[model samples]
Target: MQYAQKPELYATGTIQLWEDPHIAKGMLEAHLAPDNDAASRNHQFIDRSVKWLSTLSPVEAAPKVIDFGCGPGMYTSRLAKLGYEVTGVDISENSINYAKEDAVSNNLHINYRNESYLELKDEGLYDWAILIYCDYSVLSPEQRQTLLENIKRALKPGGKLIFDVFTPYQYEPLKESHSWYAENASGFYKDGPHLCLFSHFLYEDDVYLDQYVIIDEMDQVDVIRVWDRSFTVARLQQEIESAGLKLSAYYSNVAGDLYNEASKSLCFVVEKW
Candidate 1:
């Protein structure tokens, strides 16, 4: 008797898929779904960011703010409503289009651009810059430095830069095994109820890799892999300073508490001198 060889399994996906226009649209819509309670979360985050900004010395009347990687325009809409002239930029054209449509539906005037953050020009025009959702960690050290330099050139003297980063504590526990599964009737209507398996690995000091396998009832499986990095407070501070920005405050939470080693989030408030 002859036995067939078992098939080899390899993680297969493209950065291009994540950057796809339609896929980006679908993902954003899913997050912004009316019944998802995401709207409430958006409002809460915006309220907290606004309160923090209010504590700062007011910028010249009607400060201009830019939201880098403004997915679906959630925070962009919030900031605009708070009276800041807001512009949202993303690398996905589809996401930008969706954001523009969303702004129209909400009757909010926002500038939505389909451009990479690195390509944004410095006209010395902005008063504030924000990179939320731990997005800044996506860049390499050199890219981060370049981004800071660009932000500084884009801001007026004394303008501020605020962003957040994940800490090492979050990664330590994530190195363990984790898995979850869910099933629902919506399967026929959309990407059906599925079972998800997750595996995590600490690739380096600040880098982690997560593999996600989604299996439908029919045994079809789709695997997605994501890689992310965490930044230490000291390393982050050094980058900010090297970029010519002054670190004025650091908080471990959205509510503005002093940062501790174990804090999962490191929110930064830096001013351009």
Candidate 2:
């Protein structure tokens, strides 16, 4: 096995982290972990975020909202409860199923679809489009462009896209590193004994990658690569305007706090031009 080898940029993992049954279960668990920020933000932060989002369009406005990567309806259900017309899209069928079931149990009216947000084709359909939890930072440059275009098409004139991305400060402390471990009990990567090799990489353009190479008892190997591209205000503005959208406002977080250089992440409100 090629241990600690860096693959090409944006190379896909052998197993789809979001779609694979075993990994998806772990991802869902991470998302549901009350205090964990592994997948979704902590519940308290999500509560505050939903409350802040509600204020964007008064409940009386009854605005339409499309949430990309809306895992297990964490934010969608809350927004729906606040009377927004909500539709959630996610690539993980496992997550979508859970979200759909939860919506039913709560008697919340939400449209949940198991599909990549990049496949969104709606044209001028929503008053607000949200991609939270800094999911925007993981996409490749080309993918980011496609996503921006898709979001632009999905929004109505004057509609706003609210998203967040990590700032350079977020990864300031992570240095290039490599490690490995053996697990006999079932864990996040698989259901049986495995040797997991890990590599933390820092690349140009404020990008970082966390790579995992997993080898099972049968010698079957798989790889998972997670990429994060941090951004500055100037870089973000350039990208937003390049997509034919206008950067209306930016903050340190989705909670609408003003941004400062020391902030580790940034939230942006981009309007369809």
Candidate 3:
């Protein structure tokens, strides 16, 4: 058994699906279908976003928007059609390519960048920055800080940055489990016949780790550690304040329902202070 690399902490040493060709190709296609991925990104949910996000948008002309982790440009093209200047960014080369092609085919003017949003400098001049689908919960503490600061610098004065995150209530009763599958013709790692061991770990009040150990037919091992960092409402607010951002809006979900302890998912809309 071998690891791609040593993890920095819990699950930092892994090649995510975003960087894997075999996985990202399937992911892009899955993104088109409603509720295809583990995450629920159904068409109805996405279409409703226009109204949900509009609560924070300007009234007159469309606001300049930046879609962080804009996967396959799903929301990017839709937002553009709704009359907003949009820019989509993702880490996957395949996803970026597909987004770019779609934009061209549709004759929509959207700037698509194949880059890591975490490494993005404070170089954007936009009215809104959105990171939907609870992508914010996956980053480590340090990365989350960097992301918040970067978004703060990128937004114009009074600009709003919105993103979703999972609360600790949503991840209680930490489950340590495992699953396996025999080599099949199709899967994320489709190189050849392989043994797959999938497992998860939860640290007390810390992070949820989705760890994978795969052995290919050639006896090659691949270890993947995907960490999902969760937060409590109070804790998240404090972190946002530390980043020099003001939490102006909080919701149970993108649907705009009021958030509370019972709400597993929370949407936060912050302003650069």
Candidate 4:
């Protein structure tokens, strides 16, 4: 296999990792994995996060909530259980189907949409919007602007958007690296034998990328790129403000820990301005 030069920033991958059928299956497994934070945070942390989020929109208020990237409805289901009107949007059909099944089994009424949140269209429909699990850090600047605009359109006037982003502290030890592996059986990357070339890149402005090039026995190749952009409070505030949103409050994390410069992540509640 030929070595690939580092890609330009925010280049689209050959496949959308979250929506690819095989990868989606593996993603669902990772999300449901009780012990790992590979796809979603551990269940215990989720419980705490959901509880803290509830305090933001008490059941007595009967608030309408929209959860972006609601993988398997982990947060949406919990919020629904608290009697909040919940809508979950995701790009993965597999995850949405699983979430729908679980919601039905529990007799919980939730609106689950299998679509990209970047294209969110409901205007002035929700009181609270959540993009948890640090998903906000995955987008490029342009994509982020679009997402914030879409979310702004989706929320009521003065409505709030709650999300988290990693900080430089989270990657203080990250370094540029490259490696490869061969998988002969059904695995995270494929259902059959394939060769995988992996690279980890660190860029200026606290940006990082995990790039994977997968080649099957037939020589078909697929490239997957996962980008993360860490943020400082000032940087995050500027980005939101450019989209007509204002930061209302911030914490070290979604769990409501006090914000500090050394924290690995920063969570914010921003209002449509």
lDDT per residue, candidate 4, 1-273, as tens digits?
Answer: 344677888887899899799999999999998778889988888899889988876777638999999999989999998899999999999999999999999999999999999888899999989998899999998889889989999999888899999999998998899999999887798889999999998887888999999989999999999999899999998888889998999999888889987999999999987
Q: Per-prediction TM-score, please?
A: 0.76, 0.98, 0.92, 0.97
* Best model per TM-score: 2
Candidate 2 lDDT, tens digit per residue, 35-78? 99999999999999888878875667637999999989999999
- Of 2 and 3, the candidate ranking higher by lDDT: 2
Which RMSD values do the candidates have, in order? 5.5, 1.0, 2.5, 1.2
Work out how many backbone clashes candidate 4 has: 0
Number of residue pairs clashing in candidate 3, backbone atoms closer than 3 angstroms, sequence gap of 3 or more or interchain: 0
* Model 2 worst lDDT window (10 residues): 53-62
TM-score of 4: 0.97
lDDT measured at residue 237 in model 2 versus the true structure, 0 to 100 = 95
Q: Write the per-residue lDDT of candidate 1 for residues 1-273, one digit (tens) a residue.
A: 001111122224333434744446566665476455331235555567667764553435636888888877867887777677888888877777878998899888899988888777866788888887776775655667777877888888888888888888766665445655575744311265777666665555577656666677897766555556788888889878888899988898544667887898799989989
Candidate 2 Cα errors over 4 Å, as ranges: none
TM-score of 1: 0.76
**Pairs clashing within candidate 1:** 187-192
CA lDDT of each prediction against the hidden true structure: 0.70, 0.91, 0.79, 0.91
Candidate 1: stretches off by over 4 Å: 1-13, 33-42, 57-62, 176-199, 212-225
